[model samples]
Target: MTYMVLLAASFGYVFLKAWQQRNVAFDHVWWVLPTSYAMAVVEVIVVTKIVMTGGNWLAVFVLGTGGGFGALTAMWFHKTFLTRRE
Candidate 1:
């Protein structure tokens, strides 16, 4: 359960942060503000949970793996679904 939550939190944290950055770069204030707010909230939760519970090597590995996939998926998701191309 802990590992699963950590995985999800890490994935969400990275995705929102990356999405926020993309929104900013594209000059989309509407997207930027909300993503920023969400990212901050998630960041707080992820850090607090990890700090309070502590993790073994396996948990740490899961966190890293989730983050890696999150970043890759974020870029693809924003470009493929969010961006408007003409």
Candidate 2:
């Protein structure tokens, strides 16, 4: 459950940050800073867990799975909430 939540947050923030950068000229989105910070925190937890578990293949595989889930979550959020016709 913890992994699922953190994975979703991490991926959502990454997608938000990338979108902010790609769609702007010199403007800044205040929300992106906090999202980036959250992603950093979640990644630290994930990395520490993976490393403390001896960096085995299964651990790495689970990490990858978490990341993939994160990406999917981000994509879904972007499509459902962020996209706008312009």
Best by TM-score: 1
TM-scores for every candidate against the unseen true structure = 0.86, 0.65
Q: How many Å off is the CA of 77 in candidate 2?
A: 0.7
Writing each residue's lDDT as its tens digit, candidate 1 over 1-86 gives 77787888889998887888888888778887778888898888788768756766876887788788888899999999878799
As a whole number from 0 to 100, the lDDT of residue 15 in candidate 1 is: 84
Tens-digit lDDT track for model 2 on 13-82? 4555554453343343555677667667766776666556676776656666655765666566655665
List where candidate 1 sits over 4 angstroms from the true fold. Answer: none
Collision count for each candidate, in order: 0, 0
Best by lDDT: 1
